[model samples]
Target: MKRRAWIVWLPPVLSGAFLIALWYAGRAATGLQSWILPTPGEIFQAAWNEHATLLRAAGGTAVGALGGFLVAALAGLAIALVLGGARWLRTGLYPWLLVVQMTPVIVVAPIIVLWAGPGLPGIITVTFLISFFPIVVNTTQGLLSAEAPMVDLFRMYGATRWQELQLLRLPSAMPYFLAGLRIAATLAPIGAIFGEYLVGNASGGTGGLGFLVYVYNTQIKIPALFATALTSCLLGFIFVAAVSWLNWALLHHWHDSFERHDR
Candidate 1:
């Protein structure tokens, strides 16, 4: 199984390597001009030269993403709980929730900036807008989708509303919550970057990767810009992998999703 996993990864690794070779060849063919595309070596050199600055940008972006994700998780849980407990509230609010999701973050971000006036608060608002929806939707579905018989049994045994929520509904919702979290982990970085693009500032000189991308592009440091962009992508992927591992660990014991047996 381990070997199979490695084998699966091998193709993508090789493909990336091949693409880099092609890129280098193209740069060579074009004489490594800055007006044209930069060579792999030049890009690597640029990245190395700006490694500290790039690292700082990466750290800032991660902080914003995580901060926003934390807020979203809490807010989503609260919203899901309210929806679960009150059918009328769910009916009234669900459509609006969907509307919020349908609206593009780019369009809403400027409004958020106007409301918040700027800085991390504005960025976090954008991040929250983008990351909160999946959590609420998935968690609400999980909470309300409890087995009818199981709920009846709980009621028969005199389970209070709070007891039912704590023991039955919340437990039932765990898998769905984790699934949403995995999605959020991937999305948070994107939200942060999008927010940064609008806000154009992060905590101090450690502005997020998007700001760095803007600066590098203006300076015509195409290679450095690409490197910073790639770094953000890699950061998002790392969060994805972390969430996947967490999901596997959390669900492997009881959930059929982790079953290794034949269907």
Candidate 2:
């Protein structure tokens, strides 16, 4: 198992290393100005120098992402449940959810910023908007996709609707719910970053990693900008990996996705 993971990770690690080496070679060969294309050494130095600032920005972004994710997960599940009870409601709301996802964030972000007073609330709203869709869609599918035989057995046992949902449907939904969560976890950062970049909150507060990127870009600090961007990607990967691990631990023994692989 450990070997398999190392094998899976090897390509990405090697690819990243090769890309960095190529970047270094290109930067060194061109002797381009630092602002134009920073060498790996310069980017490393910038990262080291700005570590504290970057850490704080990362923290703020993480907090908003987590808060928004939690709120979305709870509300999304409840909404899905309500919709599950009524086919008409599900059909009605389904299109709207699709519409919301289809709408570009750029068009909606300023309005959110204006209504929410910017900063964390605006970021959270954006994050929620981006994250909620997956949860609703996945959980609803899971809840409704309970195996027919099992559902029939529950009905034979004279199971109440709520009882059947609690004992049978929800358990069946766990894997799907986690899958959506894993997707949502990474998306939260994207939503938060988009919010920050679009609104440019007037609080004069340092916005977050996205803001950090904008600042570095504006200041012509190529290396620092790349470093911050890399950090944001790392944060996103971490979120996805964490959720994947949690899903494995929770469902590996019972869920087919993990169990079949284990076999």
lDDT of each: 0.84, 0.83
Model 1: lDDT of residue 143: 95
Candidate 1 off by > 4 Å: 2-5, 25-35, 202-206
Model 2, C-alpha of 168: deviation from truth (Å): 1.0
* Clashing residue pairs in candidate 2 (N, C-alpha, C atoms within 3 angstroms): none
Across 60-138, the per-residue lDDT of candidate 2 in tens digits comes to 7887778788888898888878877779998888888899889988888768878986788888888888898889889
Q: Which of the numbered candidates is closest to the native, going by highest TM-score?
A: 2
RMSD of each: 2.6, 2.2
Question: Cα lDDT for residue 71, model 2?
Answer: 80
**Residue 223 lDDT (model 1):** 80
TM-score of 1: 0.89
Clashing pairs in 1: none
